[model samples]
Target chain A: MKITCSKSNLVKGVSIVSKAVPSKTTMPILECILIDATTDIIKLTANDMELGIMTEISGDIIDRGMIAIDAKIFSEIVRKLPDNEVTIETLDNLQTVITCEKAKFDIAGKPGDEFAYLPIIEKEDSIEISQFTLKEVIRQTIFSISDSESNKLMTGELFDISDNILKVVSLDGHRISIRKVPLKKSVADRKLVVPGKTLIEISKILSGEAENVVSISYTKNHIVFEFDNTIVVSRLIEGEYFRIDQMLSSDYETKVRINKKELLSCIDRATLLVKEGDKKPIIINIGDELMELKIKSQIGSMNEEIMITKEGKDLLIGFNPKFLIDALRVIDDEEVTIYLMNAKAPCFIKDDAESYVYLILPVNFNSAA
Target chain B: MKITCSKSNLVKGVSIVSKAVPSKTTMPILECILIDATTDIIKLTANDMELGIMTEISGDIIDRGMIAIDAKIFSEIVRKLPDNEVTIETLDNLQTVITCEKAKFDIAGKPGDEFAYLPIIEKEDSIEISQFTLKEVIRQTIFSISDSESNKLMTGELFDISDNILKVVSLDGHRISIRKVPLKKSVADRKLVVPGKTLIEISKILSGEAENVVSISYTKNHIVFEFDNTIVVSRLIEGEYFRIDQMLSSDYETKVRINKKELLSCIDRATLLVKEGDKKPIIINIGDELMELKIKSQIGSMNEEIMITKEGKDLLIGFNPKFLIDALRVIDDEEVTIYLMNAKAPCFIKDDAESYVYLILPVNFNSAA
Candidate 1:
């Protein structure tokens, strides 16, 4: 491929597509980025079988041709090139020449015909959502996805959309997180399980701007996201997501409204007594206007009290400190209400607007001391 | 031990001594920080057998006693304590109680008698130098120290003091680096090898200010560094350091004077073509007012020309880009001069004052392409 582009524009295009390039692949072409200048606008594409990305380069197309070059070295060269126009040309032997000011690079390239093609998406049933809202929902729920390879279904998040509302739910065996957002308009009901890895990569690429809208289209086995100048296609996991709705409850015996920062810090301090590989849990005692956090390990014991506004009967529960920290860290609220049923039942942290819900199972300690 | 101190004061003292705490040791006492409150000033000490550090904490000593507590947990508790007066008391069962604000912790402690004591150093042989100069010298030469465990001496830097001048040298199998600084006054001449790991920890604790003076002393097997409110004692590496002085020569066939930044950036770009496990070396062609850097690998080839002022004959040579970058990154010069002998001899990068010298051996490539 022959093309002339500014350093900044070329670097941005390469980086966006390089994210999909497989670091170690048995097929050499999978490690390369296909550059196609056959059209009016230059295009760069990369596919790792499971995930694929394509981006358009805003530059002058000198000749209509296509070739694939190693993604890592090409991107590095473009990023370090002086802030000037860069010229890239390919020879008959598929050798690419990249030149910018006083610097020049001649690298070997392979024909683009062998590169895997990105799965096509029928756009008739596509939906649009603000990139900011989509990114926020993914961030809130992706952390709870199980990283274990044995259960493939738990490695993906469930995307359920109905009417104008989109709900994303993720659960490992220990906890479940759900986030809901309203779309700009109503759409037909659909459900898709997107791999957590794919959502993480997409979240990184999204601009997260309120004005930027992402058009999402899906088929039986593949899904596509179109935003900015890039298109990402990912394979959907073929399995049913956990029935998380049945596990959540609205009834509670005790409810407390406490400062998020205060509770988080108190639990964090109690965790100091916990050693690595220790299965100790932080215990919480909720009472009138007062909440106490306690942790006892073989090495030490720690406890701290935090003032809170409580309602209903007093309750005592124990939970993994990391689970509570993970939920509290993403919450953008001054104070949050936590609902508890009993020491053996799951506890819930939800908002009055019903935008986010987090349920964590309490740990059953042999002794409360 | 009973003491009352501000959270900040206690945290600082714990962090400084905690660096010497053994992360995993067969002897449990090695993982504890000895709290010696018997003196008027509260002191914290930790020793990992090879390295020991002690720091005086600003606190009101209520009772004269001593105890050893787990360093990791103690530091974590102190760091999370509220910014108020922290009261630490030891009970008869060797259980330590730490209380600050509304939080309290009861942790198990060991008798201080079992903890390793710091090696004492005679002050009559100590030499004082500005901490800023010492830190700068260590930064300039520490990168060249060999990290291989087979040659223990090469993993340390040689500190040679004579006549009011101190010279430090470090050498791996491939290169040698030397830095010189003038002491405040003349003292007894001595030479000792300090482990690179110890120097790294000391460098972190040193306050790099011109007004901060560091008192250094050494015995037959131990070296001490005293600055501010902290003192670090470390065992000196046995055996003689490499004789690097004989490897440095005042000879050159070509010399080039160029901007340090320009050369660094050029080499960095040339390195993009080199992949890990690739034995390719960046080649340099020195001629007149222009210098060219080239690198040819199995995947690609890159070359860039840098403007320079040359003296002596034109030459071609190859060297590892990493060694050059390491030296140039630490140099605080706008422009530096490089002296080259031949394609097989070592090259030197030095300033006009000769306070610092870095010698890097060139790689012999099969073809000078």
Candidate 2:
């Protein structure tokens, strides 16, 4: 196999596919990137059993062939090469030569036939969403996903679409995050749970341009994401998703409207007293027009006050400061309204337009006892 | 103690002295910063026995008192405070209250009397040099200092000043680096070995502006650095420095002039084949007008060529690529001259003005055998 490509094209293609390379695996070929130049275009693919990424790059295929090169070494070599043309040639003995300007590296590559191929998915039902909206939704909900794999459903997010509205939900047993976004085109309604790690990788590859869109296809066992010149295929978790609708509550005895930035910074400041692995909760005392947040940890204690517009009855509640900070950071609003049912119930913070909703369970405070 | 200071001034003072706080220690007092508000000026001091840093910050000292606060929590609280005036006061029970805007924090403090003080050094003699020059000299030679503590003298850089010239030398087992700088004012001749860790911290604190000068003073057991409103005191390593002059040689049978950027980049590219804990040396083949660098490791082999101006007979030598890359990175020259005596002898690279000299010992190349 022989191919000549520009340094910029090869680097861009390698980086996009490199994310799917298995960091640790028993099979050595699983750590390689297969370069298929059988046609006019050069295609690079990396599959790690769970997730696979493939990208097509523009290059001249002097001789059509295929080879699997170690991704770690190849990426490093490409990144440091001069910004010029690079030529890759594979010999019959699997000895590959990569030359750019005055530098030449001879690396032993494995046979492409020994590598595992990406699982094919039937793209029958597909939906379109803007890249910006997808990235924002992932950022808003991915944090709440559970890191444990014992309950497989909690480690993945439920992407349910119905009546042209798509809602993404993730919960970690303690808190739940739900983000609702509208689809650009109407398609068949579908529901699938995507692994959190795959969503994180997809978010990194997306652009912020609202005009660019990503087409997502869902099958019985696999899901595919296609955008630009790349395709990502990830296995869907086979399990029943959580009934997030039943967990969400809108009835409240007391509601308050607070400035987003002031509340975020106030809670963030209180977090300094709470150390890692410590279950310290921030207690909130709601009064006439001011809300005071207080926390006392083993290290120290902090108290901060912010003005708010409260209605109904004044109430006191406690919550994990990190859960509040996470939701507040992703919320892009001048003012956010919080609804509290009681001291023991979950606190709800949602936008007036019903586009985003955050529910955080209250922590028991012993100050009153 | 009560004091009101700007957030900027407080943050800067805390950050500068916080570097001296011990990361882990048996005595917890060493992890605290002593805030002394006895006079109009507020002094912040942190002493970890080995190194001490104190800086004076402008603030309104309402009453004369002193207290010690935990460095970790105080730095965090100060960093997240509102950008307004902050008032800090100590209660009768050693509970300190810090108020900024609507946020207030109560943290426990220790008596300042229990903290260790910096060792006093006789500041009778001092030398003046720009911080830029001192930082440059440190950056040029610090890489050669040995990190292992088995050999106490190798872990420090020799700072020898005499005849209006200051030459700094640091050498590990493999190579030696020497840097010479002209001092504006010459005082009593002195030679001392400053700990490498101390020099690293000082380099970080020094500003790049050459006009800003730092006064350096040395004593029998301590070294002091004073600049801007801050003072740093460190214990000096006591031992006889190596006889570096005896190892220097001027006679050479082969010489070459190469572009600094090309050689550095070429060597850096060749380093891709060398892995951690691997002892792969880059073999150099010197010819009439071009120099070729080659390296073969367990992963692969790489070869690169660079055009050069050669003199005398050709030679073949091998050396660790990291040693060459380190010296080449710090030298701010467009072109560099290399002088070699034989295949097995040490190579000398020097500037035209003799301000910098690097001697690299060659490795045994088995490729020829």
Candidate 3:
């Protein structure tokens, strides 16, 4: 293979595909990135069985051939290349020569046929959404996904679409996070569970710009995302997602509207006295126009209060400070409304329009202390 | 004890003394920062038996008393406190109450009498120097200090003063680096070996500004640094420094004046092919007006050339790229002159005025391969 490209363009292409290279594998070929100049535009591809990424880079193709190079070494070389036009060509014995200005490197390469290619996904069943909205959706729900390897269903988030509304839900037996976004156009109803790790990687790659749009599609076992001349494909988690509709309701005995930043800071300060691996819960006492938070650990104790607008009966509950912090951090609101049924039931932080819903199970303070 | 101070001032003072707190220690009290409000200005201190640091902070002392609190917890609390005046007071039973705005924390504290204070270092044997100069000295020579704990002498740098020059020298078994600076006035000749770890911490705390001056002093077994209301005392490493002057020679068979940046870039690019823990040597071939650098490994081979002005006989030599890189990275000159005797002799990168010197031992390419 022979090609000429600018250093910046080559570095960008290599970095995008390097994310999918298998870090540890028995088959060495899986750690290689296939460069195909035979295509109209030069293409770089990496596949680790579970996830695959491909990007098309603009370069002058001197000859039409293909080869695979070690992803880590090739990426480092391209990044450190001088800021000028670079030429890459194959020599006898499958040796690749990469030169820029006065610097030249010769590395061994393998035939592209030995590499695995990304699986083909039919694009007929797809929907378009702005990259900004998709990134926000992933950021709000991905944190709640269970990382346990033994339980297959909890490691992925459920994607359900119907009635012009798309909902993403994640639960780890301790808390449930759900975000819903209104669609611009109606499409066929579908449900799929995407692995949490894939969504995290995708969120990092997404530009998160309102002008950029991504097409997402699903098959029986694979999901694909296409945007900005790049394609990402990952195998779907094969299992039935938990049924969560019955657990979510509008009924509540107590409701409070408090400043998000004020409550977040108060709970954050209370957490200073609690040590890691210690289940010391932050007890909250809700009353008329006041909410006091307290925590007493082996180290010390802390107490703080914030004024709030309350309605209905008063309530007292205790919760893991981290769960509250996580939900509050992702929320972009001046004030959040919370609904509580009782101390034993789940507490919900939701919007009246059902745009976003966060349910956290309270901890038994007597036992946790 | 009771005191009110701004969050920023308190945070800075706590951070300065917290560096002396032992990360892993059998004595728990060593991990605490003692706050004494009995003096006119509040003072914070921490000691790990080997190193001690103390700083005075501006505050309003409501009462006269002292207490010791956990450094880690106190620093975190002060950092997260609201942007207002923070009040820290001790109640009966040695309970400390810290409040800012509406957040309050009650933490346990110990009697300050149990805490170890910094040793008093006499200022009779002292010299004044700008903080910027001391910081620059540490940055240029600290990288060459040996990190291996086997040889105690190699793990520290020699600080010597004679006539009007202050010279600092650091060397491992394979290489030596020396940096010298001219002083305005001469003082008594003295030599001391400061531990590498102590210099690293002192460098971080020193503000690199020409207007700020730091007073450095020495005792029988301690070195003290005083500046900006802060004092740091550390035990000196005991032993005799190596005799490196006899090995430094100016006679050479070949000399080359090359662009410092160009050679550094060439060597850095060649390093991409070398893996960590791999004893790879980069061979240099110096001819009339061009220098060629080459490296070959199991993976592949790389070759590059840079233009230079050479005087004397042509030469061939090889060296471990890392040792050359460390010295080259710290140099501030645009162009450097190198003197070489032969393939088996040490290479010298030095100045005509003897302001700086770097000697590197060459590798046997035949055995290394």
Candidate 4:
């Protein structure tokens, strides 16, 4: 295979596929990226059994052939090359020669036939959505996914489509985040459990682009997302996701409105004294005209009070400070409303405009008073 | 003890002294900073048995007393407080109460008597040096200090002073860096081995100031540096330093001059293929007008040739690419001159100005032709 491509385009294409390359595996071929050269284009693909990425770049192809080279080494070499055209040619002995300016590298390549085949997506069932909207949905709900794989269902976020709205929900039993965005066209209703890793990769790639559209397709066990000249596919987890709406409280005995920045800063200050294994809990005491936050650990203790507008009854609630801070960062408003049922009930926090809702389970602490 | 001080000044003072606080040690009191409050000033001191730091800030002191508090917790509280005047008061139970605006913290304190007493400077033999010059000298030579404590003498930088000239030398057997500066006044000739950690802390604190002068004092067993209302005392490492100048060769068989940035970039690209657990040696072959660098590892290999102006006999040398990059980064000139005696001998690299010099030992490779 022989091809000549712009240095910057090849760097970007190789980097995107390198993220899916397996670092350590029993199968040696998994660490290599398959490169194919046609008359006018070069395709690069890499997979680690669970997820696969393929990208194509326009280049001047001298010959038609295929070879698989070490993904990490190729990416590093391409990143450091000077701004010029890079020529890669495969020899009869299965060694690839890469030349740029005065530098040349000979890398041993494996036969492309040994690489695993990637899933093929059908264009008939694919749906189009804005990359910016999808990125926002992933960022809002991905953080709430459970890191543990023992419960396969909780480790993935649930993507449910009904009527004309697309909803994403994630929960780790202690906290849940739900986000919804309206679709432009009506399609068949579907539900899929997308793994957190795939969502993270999609988010990273989408962060650089503007408001471009993304094409998505899914089968029973696999999903694919196509954007620009790249495609990403991942296997879906098989399980039943919990009904998160049922877990939220129906009635609240107390409600308080506070500045999001002030509350976030207060929680951050209290977290300094919260011990690691001693349960990092912060107590929030609501009064007639003020709210006081307190945290006590083995080393020290801190208290911060801020003025707030409270209604109904005065109450006290204890929760992990980190959870509060994470939820506050996602809300797109200056002021947030917190609804509390009791000391042990889950607290629902949302902006007064009610764009996004977050539910956090409160910890039962003896120091809540 | 009670005192009120500006928030910015308190944060800066506490941060400087906190660097000496021991993170983990057998003596619990070593982790605390002693606070001494007088009518006009407040002093903070911390020591880890090997190094001590004391910083004083002007404040309104209500009473004269002393107490010790955990340095980490105190610094954290001070950092998060609002930018306003802060009041720190000690209770009868030995708890330090800190209040700033609406935020309050009560930190547990230990007895001030349990803290270690810092060493006192007894002589008038002190030399004044600008913080800017001192910081530059430390940054250039500190990276060459030996990290392994097995060779106790090589772990510290040798500081030699004679009249108005000051010189610093550091060597780790394989590489050496030397820096020299002229002082304003003449002083007695002295030599001291200052630990690497002490120099790092001093550099960090002296980063922003432009005109502040550092006053240095050395005794038989300790070295002290006083600057900007802060004093740092470190115990000298007892040993005789090696005579590095004797190891340098006087004549060279091959010489080359090249752009520092171009050479550094070439070395960085070649090192990407160096494998772990194997000696990371890069071969350099000098021909009529070009230099070729090559490295081979299990995963892949790379070759890069750069243009240079050379004279004398052609030569080949093998050395660790990381050391060469380090030496290149320290050069202040755009062009660097490299002199090589032979493939097995040490290589000398420096700029034309001769303000600094770096010596790198070549690695012996049997495969080199």
Which candidate tops TM-score?
A: 2
Candidates sorted by TM-score, best first: 2, 3, 4, 1
**Candidate 2 accuracy as lDDT:** 0.91
Worst 10 residues of 3 chain A by lDDT: A120-129
How well does candidate 2 score on lDDT at residue A1?
A: 95
Output the better candidate (2/3) by DockQ.
2
- Single out the weakest 10-residue window by summed lDDT for candidate 3 chain B: B119-128
Task: Give Cα-based local distance difference scores for all models.
Answer: 0.89, 0.91, 0.90, 0.85
Q: What lDDT is reached at residue B235 by model 4?
A: 93
Best by lDDT: 2
| Residue pairs with clashing backbones, model 2 | none
Model 4, range B162-216, lDDT digits (tens) per residue? 6677888899989989887888898988888899988988888885455888999
lDDT of 3 by residue, B48-68 (tens): 988899999998999989999
* List of chain B TM-scores, one per candidate: 0.97, 0.98, 0.97, 0.96
DockQ-based class of model 1 = medium
Which segments of candidate 2 are over 4 A away from where they belong? A367-369, B367-369
DockQ per candidate, 2 decimals: 0.68, 0.88, 0.76, 0.72
DockQ, candidate 2, comes to: 0.88
Candidate 3: regions farther than 4 A off:
none
